[model samples]
Target: MDLFSGTTFKRAVAAAVALPLAGGATLVAAGPAAADEEDYKILVVGKTLGFRHSHIDDTTRALIDLGEDNGFTVDVWDPPNDSAGWWGSGSPGQPDLTMDSTPFTSAEDLSQYATLVFVSPVDNTNSLNPATPRLLDDTELAALQGYVHGGGGFVGLHAATDTMHTVPWYGELTGGGARFASHPQQQTATMRVESPAHPSTAHLPAVWERFDEWYNYTTNPRADVHVLLTLDESTYSPGNNAMGEDHPISWCQNFEGGRSWYEGAGHTDASWTDPLFLEHVLKGVEWTAGVVEGGGNCVTFPEVDAVVAGLNTSAVGDGVIAGAIASLLGSARTAAEAGDPATAVQVLGGARSLVDHLSAAAGDRDLLASKIDDLVDWQTGLVDDGPALDLAAEAELRTMGGKQYLAVRVLNEDDAAVDITVTTPYGSKEFAAVAPTKNAYQAFATRLVEVPAGEVTVTATAVLDGETVTEEVAVAYAGTA
Candidate 1:
């Protein structure tokens, strides 16, 4: 069951009890029991030892606003903006959010956040203040590394790649095996949407022309990261450091044990107010921080899709890593179709190294293969953990055109397909031969248009494991889109 048993992959472990959370506003989060445990609070580290961006305050304000609307709170840790890190005077207080001026002390401080944001942090070696020791000292850098290696979330904006560039691993981790080299003048350039399905790039156009500072990296990141957006060198002058045909602008990756998302834009102060850019930044935070409500996983497991698309039978070797990934993908899909999300998710972790590995062969552990196992887990989790259904059966109340309607969504989350029947005080709906990893849905009109938000009960019946099973629970009817 050890995925990294050798240079090559082996079989996978099975899953035990599972209770995956649903999608949308109904998505359930393992919340903090006390104020000391803040899972939804994000720490934005804007400490700069070099040139400080003028938009740092604007970015923080925008992030706070976004967090208020979304489900998270924004905490700033920028000594440059405000040693205390809170915008006490200029910004309006958000009552529903937790706005704190916590300092980034150590690795322990990093644990308090769902994700850590590096907003235009300058390189530690570039000290502007002779008295200041600068950012990410040896202790701080080690802390950041350990935090990321232990399943933490990291988001880098604009100059984040420029920060911590003295360390090779830090540079690669921040920019996906590439370092920020240089940039040209600020101008309008075209951006190409490489993966429109990604939450950050979903709202973008196929060919987007925007005015901002464009960055060029020393090496291409496509080999290490799942690129979401690419830049067209033809649209603008990339200076002498042009990356030519395949320049990556924005990307996401599964690091050693966590998730990292980076973007090469967000330089101008105007970008903070831009609707497209805000949505991109908001979703990036949501995705890296364990997929909050209404958000989606960032990485696209190419390995899984290859199997689904049916790779040539002659192309796989029984002992190769790619072949093992193929086997694992099949097992996971079978588990999902059999309504065993646990087994499916467990199996998917074995194929993380195989993602984007177009050249991996048998018995060879191409170092690249072991980098994205958590990403594989994420993709597998979405097989049935997608936005629609998070569990077996649930009821929701949706509103459209000033009328209320009851929505019932059902998923096969057991080990076998069955006949599912969902009932409520309003009516009942039946699903015939519902298979595993599949979904069924029905809606009934309701007269609760003027009613306040409340919970309603639903009865779900299904024959699971050769036994007649029935479950009744009160479903929340409020906050449906």
Candidate 2:
């Protein structure tokens, strides 16, 4: 499948159109409706398949206001009370969908927005018999995977980590490296800002306290994701899923070819009224959408000082190595405090040379070295030798001479090359050495199936440098039955 996006086609429809909200409300922004046509737009999906939050509407309204005032507009795909498109209550219930009047179902729909925001959209993870509305089905979610892998932006709030717990990709995309386990009662608690330089936390106090349902993740996301806020367990009773000390509450990451930001707060309607929370969310969306800049890294001086101080200097017989490391970290802290994270990263990089001295002396060299590298990566937003290895697929149903056929296109939309294999129930094709370019598409054609009118999915698996990523696109085949 080719790497085409809806943003390209949205240009023809641009002309300051009116976006529909749930409850028949209308919102108009300053620029075009499509995000990539120039003025940025956000798509918020508030439909819940699990225990629905009462604040979903409030959350949607708040985002609309944010976009209206922040040089952008908002389009919502909120199905009121139990509304689904093809799965249930027709498409009319989903008003002002990001993709015009359609439900937020596939990558084609998601391609129009600069950023996709999930306001506590609980996917069908906690369902028992599927008697109610459900979130994206398999094909829909597969489309979302390819969308994000092709440089899309995503933001998750509240129970988003709990949405698709069974899916490894969604868990990593929203949860960083872990999923939500449980939450305590809604109470006022203190959250310590970790990444003071991040847009979401820049205006927050070092010890910001607020009232909300505190969620505990299955594992600490600190090791894999750039952390912004950590909950202070001492301020509240953390129930069963208590993360003792390093409890990360909010974080952001540069994942695959997309940008992601997730926050565990926003469980209450009151959070929508809170100015701090609003600003935090606005900045997060802006950052994820590439409208603002700030590497979620910005290591605070206190955090760096604490990590260095925690090192066991006992391995060094004398205090020389310890003193030297301390001096370098001190300089880093100074640079960080002076609002020069770039200089701080450089100083930290220079300190890497001193880590070799610790290695020779048999100190905690590995720990220091790894932590230093993590700091630098967070600051520079660089991963895997500074290159993205992403493969994306786009598929369409083409009819030639009264007979229906499915055409596939694959785009190596990143900096590393991959060998792609497209598989379907009817046919499969292999493309070798797909170059790392975003503008080209590799095509293949097949007669989808013997059926008359039904849906089928095409899955593409790309492997490069010992890493494998799979993307899927669904095409519906319909001929005069």
Candidate 3:
């Protein structure tokens, strides 16, 4: 069945085979080949102009690391740097990822491998002459279509998504297209995982904060792609965005006949250093190579509570942008303080648009979203509504004479100074003590006191507003008063 003919054919094609490297680039990668079967054979294709060299190098290194860890051989394809056009003047020591340096000519060359990683762009790129250029034409597309249709794998990093928008079919193959409709400011921001079970993210940290260029895709992928991780908009970014409420930072899909994944989070050298991010990229490689299974399904933000809260780039000044974000944050904070958890949640949820806006405006978004994630935690956990705090000290109680004191501190500084009250057989008394002002602080004074001998009941309340909050710990006294 032709995978491109109909939706059912596409579904059948997706389920029939796993990720396989494709094309003529497989001979150059280096690694220990699996048994006779060679479970994982990968091809890293790096050939483009004006393409950032750091991203290509980092992605190649990351693939090598994945192969080493997972027991697979990687075939790196570095065509003559001269063929890379104006942007091809890369520093030496690169273009040496693998042993193969064959010039990629057709789709048949690409079909041999199980996975194909496009590190650079290939559209109207000219290396030899201006009139004559190396472009992906009908034959190339047919070959690529066949490779993936036969269960091959695909992965694109950084600018790969920036290529081939003029060719509608190529854009569809990439799940995104050339030239983002919006390019937001670059800032450090968090990438929250939406599909934790997939191989590409099994070990990735729940929140990946790094710096990179978040492209505003010309042809969005939300309709047909399975979003894995997204940029939380509570932080700084473009004011008006085309990606809508949930902006995809990383995702995977069964395209043509193969499992594919692409991440928009690899624009910086520093980002390559993050172990978690490296692992994520590695997992995608592994999954595409069929060493791992399970591509994520499409995910949507159902409600406000589902959005992860964190700090991002909204604080950076752009005057208008900053002012607007401040207004939103102030509103969320006020709502939370006014004992309106629902209202605060909604306000904070809406703040995601702020992040999208700032990212598009700034032309860089990775760090920006990360910054927003940080701030969101402070505001969203309005009165402890954020991610849970490990504020409870060791279960062991500290002994003070005959008194037992249980130490508890706010998980975050923003949650500090909350009202706390203790209830006992004598009467209900509220203790006024400011919460620790730092991210983590010790409150040794907050302990459980044994009621004077023979007291029947003891209760403690930790309050954020009008009601008692903390868990109740009962203290039983043995002796008579």
As a TM-score, model 2 comes out at 0.54
lDDT of 3 by residue, 1-481 (tens): 2211211101111111222211111222221222245456777776553444566777778777777776655787554444444545542435456445452445556656767888755444322243444345556667777777766778888766665555566666667443345557777666787655566665666777666666666555665666678876665564446465677877776565566788876777776777877777877776665555432222222212122222233446544554565566668657755767456556756665665656454434554444344334333322333322113211122456765433322222235344434343433444454364432222233333542332212222345445444433333333222
Can you tell me which runs of candidate 2 are displaced by over 4 Å? 1-38, 81-109, 127-134, 295-347, 351-481
User: 352-405 in candidate 1: lDDT tens per residue?
Assistant: 535455444322344334323433333333343221212444555666677877
**lDDT of each candidate versus the true structure:** 0.63, 0.65, 0.52
Cα RMSD, each candidate: 15.8, 23.3, 18.3
Candidate 2 positional error at 468, Å: 57
Clashes of each: 3, 3, 63
Higher-scoring candidate on lDDT, 1 or 3: 1
Candidate 1 deviation (Cα RMSD): 15.8
Give the winner by TM-score. 1
Judged by whole-model lDDT over C-alpha atoms, candidate 1 comes out at 0.63
Which lDDT tens digits does candidate 2 get at residues 1-481? Answer: 4233321211111122111110111222211125444467778887665566778778888888887888768878766454333344433223444334434467776776778898887755643344443477677777778778766788999988877655678878885557878987889899987665456666787789899999988888765567788999999999997999889989887676677899899998999999999999988887777666543322333444455576556665425666776788788757755657677677887777777765444445675676576566455432212122454445555556755555556556556656666665456676666676643333334444443444445444455456565554454444334
lDDT of 2: 0.65
Alpha carbon deviation, residue 154, candidate 3 (Å): 0.4
